[model samples]
Target: MSKKTEFQALDLISAYSEKKKNPSHLELNQIFPNPTQPRLIGREDTADLVPSMERLGLIEPILVRKDKGKYLIVAGERRYRAAIKLGWKEIPAIVTDANEDVCYEMSLAENEKRKNLNPWEVGKAIQYLRKEKRKTAEEVSELLGYSGRYVKQLSSIARLDQKSVMELMISGKPLSVKNLEELLKRKENRGGETISPRPGSGSGRISINLSKLNGRVRDNFLKELGLLKKKYGINE
Candidate 1:
């Protein structure tokens, strides 16, 4: 997230959405945040933006997409949060009808420009696009206009477990993609560690026949399955 990359999010957004940005002062209630966007760490997070906003009065408009009756933030969650902290009922925005891919593209591009986004956030965002939006690595690469090697590095970041990555983040040690990649690989990144591969990446799966088991065994299996689902927050 340092130094401006060649990625042009707005251009791609215009291409995919084919809709002009409708600038408006939207009520905070009318807008929602992007789930895949990085989380803000409280006053400290908005501390920087708040002062600027107070002085400049929102020089830039946040990007958003209409969903249901509300607007979902496609980019600029940091600014949106700062406005909320300032008790702003209305903030400027550019609302669009962009699909998920376009929204994601803008998000990544904005992150590249801002340079505040961390490696963990980038990993999770990529993982979200892969799982929730069903985007392939190649498609993601093309969307960001990034090279395959760079996208592959990011996909590798997605492989490390959350706890471990968080620990490294807490250490506040600067980590290069290559260094983190190798460190995490010492455990899981040899291939796919915690991350599930792209849907078509492989045919690996597991199946069991509960009917073949006696009642007691089936009951025990189901109990374990229930526990697993709870641990992983899987919906029944």
Candidate 2:
């Protein structure tokens, strides 16, 4: 096996060993190390997770690092938060080797599996892997088990304005992935040109026909759609 594979196997073994050592122990002594790095965002739905943990307990262990007899949580912030909310004194966690690059990769993988991360968070993760870990975008995508084009698309989404993002979150529109791509393209064009759409262009229309868009032109089209919505009271 490669070094990476060996490390992963050992990590899993250590996790299993820790779990088997004390099946009923609750005073988990690990102090989460990377507390500042949040793997999950949008606390609006956190209440839902709490009850599940409270009922069945944490099914998965958090990843952590040890420092001075304290384990710092590296990933699984949501699980930790839920545990705290449910009044659990101790939670399960996996102690892994202190490889910053690998830790980051694992963190991203963990989050990617559990929830649909926002574009900004995904972009930040990708950026961290590239800038801090010196991994190429393609390499990062490969590590995350995502396609290179998918990674590039996520990076592009990260560059959208907060207003546009808010629109996406609040409008409750049936926005397909293709629609989001079109919206992003529109935002990019608006940045280049000072052209603003006439007021009341889209009238709050939610559904967009992505097939009509052709590269950069789609950006202008979305801006016009937003303007139309602002002008008219279309609740789509």
Best by TM-score: 1
Give stretches of model 1 more than 4 Å off. 1-4, 8-10, 13-22, 38-44, 189-236
What do the candidate models score in CA lDDT, each in turn?
Answer: 0.70, 0.59
TM-score of 2: 0.61
Report the Cα lDDT for candidate 1.
Answer: 0.70
Instruction: Write down the TM-score of every candidate.
Output: 0.67, 0.61
Per-candidate total of colliding backbone pairs: 1, 18
Runs in model 2 lying further than 4 Å from the true structure? 1-40, 43-45, 67-70, 161-164, 174-176, 190-236
